[model samples]
Target chain A: MSKAAIIPTQLSIRVPVLNWAVWPHDASVPEGPAHGFELQYIDAMTRRRLSNLTRMALHVAGVCVGKTPRVRTVFASRHGELHRTVDMLTSLAHAEPLSPTAFGLSVHNASAGIFSIARRDRSSATALAAGEDTFGYALLEAHVQLRSDPAAPVLVVYADEPLPQVYAARSCAGDRPHALAVLLSHEAVRDLTLTANRSTEAPSGGMQSLAFLPWLAQGESGSWTGHRHTWRWH
Target chain B: MSELKLQIKQLIVDALNLEDLRPEDIGDDQALFDDGLGLDSIDALELGVALRKKYLLKLDAGDASVRAAFRCVNTLAELVHARRTDSERTANE
Candidate 1:
């Protein structure tokens, strides 16, 4: 009624949600930003080096993987470990050597890799990024992985933060840094049936996962419009 | 000599993010790599940078002496102390 909504080709998908978790969950908490959420499973040496985003990601991931014996994970974040990458970049610009430890953990999938190490999980983890549809794509990836994966459940972890001040000149839609993990298994009840439609609209700046979380929790059904695809959960 | 060993232990703990460990927890003769501290190759690389920053200690990765020097906290301390005294002697000359 407001505008002419284009009808696009849609792909139907059915995936079950076994469990879910999020981090920095309390928005009303009056404390400063903290990444020191302790986990008994992770050693001090390993936990100390992680960024807040990675910590949040790991926290939600550990929660979702609660009692599951093993899982193959797909980690998605638009700006993965951006702060660490920025630090390493600054060192390079100043002609200083990058810290070997930082260099090792600066990858996009470092959180997934650390998850594997912490759990001592030999299961494979896939890390990916797609501008606005990272979470949506992760779901797609997980669905495919579940078909071939002999594992019980596939864990999908998504987290993102606002751009660092150093890169303030570049604009990003403001997003509260939060991490979400969803466990999907074929045996579980399929709560939401996903339908992805190809669209020509520009990407909705904010994270799709953030939009999907509330819809998944509260609404009977909802749809997310991205640059290339529109995903509906009902 | 013991003070230097303690100093080296502290450096290792701080540099490697081994916050769970204290300098006193590390024995002088404990192996640094697989057996005792359980450090791996990446840790050795990180320690090399820290050693250079603190004591100007630079050892070739390919050198046999470098491996021997890093065998334990005691060996690392000896190497760092030797490097410092040698640099000081050159500075005085």
Candidate 2:
């Protein structure tokens, strides 16, 4: 639980060189092929192994890192294949043998592992889950990695699907599957600053990543206030 | 192709999530791994489970013949047909 009390004046990060989002069933989202993840970058066999969450994450990550052989990656998700986990639990309760493939792909970092395997990427990767602050924390992790190595860009991906119907009563986030990916480098073309502070505000209703979409899509430099912190783009 | 072969082909396609592929598209004799359908070890494990669940067939993971039985659509169909016949014969006896 690292906390940042002061906003550093010299802290800055670049705008995304490539950005992609997928939200197929969201009515507010445009009905088009772009939102439909074809996952053409992954072959049919490998694509079959992915759950919806992994597929979405891999799709956006693939689009962001097109042609690049190797790059650091940060994957963040709130629920992360919760449906698959539920399936595993149901199988256990029934005394049925678990599907080996399903068990292998049920981890929190499964999307990142699949992306690395599909791309044959051997670079460092990180997976984070920080409740309401997952997207922001993932971005900060990517920025830290970029600071360590200024040459290679970092691919940050945030993806999550709606919680299973069994947990619908407890779900706090939106009921749609969504994923967002961005390629971040050290070069400050379009600067963004993240500030952390204590606040008593209630957490937002939807995915934290969605808050940045308006700014990212419109290229508007503005500030977005979150549950515990705020982000500003200039 | 035989109806059993077609059913097995459909099973493979459905069980393995072979997107954009149909039963007729997969040749009866085409290899199921690496070159033809390009399935891998994980897919093989998944398809094996699907076949067992659908057909109630007994499969031994350590059996040497399992690899040969899973080479292609024709081989897999033959294996299923033979196993089903054996099970029926044993019941009749």
Candidate 3:
């Protein structure tokens, strides 16, 4: 007997809290770059060790889960520290040794690893990168974790930085550095239903997480349609 | 403060990214590890690399003197001064 695959028709989640940080691309500021990241939540020495992408992720994650540890975490990024990887490659090409600190913190899951260390959290953490649908997959992973333990909340952080100039030709929607954190639980404050389907339409530009930011910021029920799926929050 | 001590202090601050700290703020004999400047192992490794690059000194990770030399800014300055003198003396020979 052949077994058929089962696809979930809908998924529900309750977001107890959410936080986001987005860099300003326009030349509104007179002097320094406008990253829009205060990051007062982290200490000075710890902050020094973080990259821009990790800093954004940790900032939002700290805000969403204040003084709360021992919760499962899912971090998603499309291009995780591409600039750092490029720098390492350039150094190799020149026969220069790589910086130990940079090499240690340049992985795709470095943000999640640093978050765990900073918070002293021992709970399970997962890092994901799935093309443009990374944010959706991360949320689904968080949902699975929430289902496993109803009492514990799962923190999902999505952060991405713009691709290096070498790969600028393939940039997508909202490619600027940004981070979003959502605290999900089984207790339903709001219901998010995700439906997957096939479509040939073009995907949204920049990071997929950007599309859900507006709906979350407004705190109103809405729907966002992606290239191959639709997310409804009500 | 001695010039070498001041230089080592500045190197520590810069290499470790010790924000809100200046060279003058660090005491010459103050402890740099836990209970003082609160630096950890990673900072130790980074400072060791910086010292090697700046002073052209060799550092042995397994050597006991390395930890003693890192005890304070005074000890670090003394280590750097000794290494420089040794290199100069060897060159003269």
Candidate 4:
């Protein structure tokens, strides 16, 4: 990897984490169509239209949210529903009309929007993507939202599947579908610290978001190296 | 239910990804949009695609009769029955 552009890496941020959740925690099963995911949390009507990535993303988001009401959300993904996009592109190539549902939910934040609709939550939510560093940036976003409003909690969700075989070379998913979620607040049960330093190492496998789950849920601290810097969480 | 209605019901269920709903669960006259049946505008467009692909249907979204036919499975069945090829009409019965 070429030298990454210089970025501010000295400002240490401490974000209070209230709760966290992750899907397929075992890591044995790879990211694909088949999983043990259930649909009870999502209603029959809405769940019908969800793709595997969205379903996994929503599952962890729901688990983290639990009965917690009105939490702002930041859903980040490296590739948002790329499978659906591929299918649509294929249809268009043959001069075919695209599926309406596929077109409607192709945006990166579709899962976030669906979560809001399912929760009947009108709170502010953001859907974002930042290449392989999506998880780190989403945490930063949640940290900002929590600092801005001390009263409410912010939900940080990162879900990504291995790029479909066509886009596999650029994938950081390591060929496994994973979603990691953390509920952040100004003051919470655990004190979580985030710091970054410049790095020139080539990006590696494993979802950084899932790697950080251990730090939030149990371990003392962990470091994830990606995109031009190494992010340390404690 | 007539043979055509049953086929349309199956198409509706499959095309909309209505996993929980069976073909029989939908009444012949059940409202299809924003009512008891709980379909939205997107569902309408999806059903339109299903119709076009399966029946080679030519749909006119702006037409008043098209809107009416989309109101219920019974109306949709009728539209399909009227629009299908002669061989399909005879084969279906």
On lDDT, the leading prediction is: 4
Residues A1-234, candidate 4: write the lDDT tens digits. Answer: 433444675657888888888888666665445566655767777788888889988988988888898999999997889999998998889777789999988888899999999889999999999876788889889889888998999998888877777777766544477788889976588878888777567655567776776785566688878757788887
Better of 1 and 4 by lDDT: 4
Q: What local lDDT score does residue A104 receive in model 3, on the 0 to 100 scale?
A: 84
Clashing pairs in 4: A31-A177
Best by DockQ: 4
DockQ sort, best first: 4, 2, 1, 3
**Scored by CA lDDT, what does every candidate get?**
0.80, 0.75, 0.74, 0.82
Q: Least accurate stretch of 10 residues (summed lDDT) in model 2 chain A?
A: A1-10
- Candidate 3, residue A170: the lDDT equals 82
Candidate 1 falls in which docking quality class? Answer: acceptable
lDDT of 1: 0.80
User: Residue B89 in candidate 1 has what lDDT?
Assistant: 38
Off by over 4 Å in 4: A1-6, A9-11, A29-43, B34-36, B85-93
Per-residue CA lDDT of model 3 for A1-234, tens digit only, reads 322234344555544443333333232333244256657766777788778788778777877776665778999898888888998898689765566677888998898887787777888999998777788788878878887887988888888877898887888754566778888865446556554444335544445677666666665555555565555554
RMSD value for candidate 4 = 3.3
- Greater TM-score among 3 and 4 belongs to 4
Give the alpha carbon lDDT tens digit for every residue of B1-93 in model 3.
398788888898887878789999999989999999898888888888778767777778888997799999999988887775445436756
Per-residue CA lDDT of model 2 for A3-61, tens digit only, reads 44454423445444444444443548643443467587676666776887887888778
lDDT of each residue in A16-73, candidate 1, tens digit only: 8888787766644543666545466787667867778888888889887897878999
Q: Report how far residue B82 has shifted in candidate 3, in Å.
A: 5.4
Error of 3 at A16 (Å): 8.6
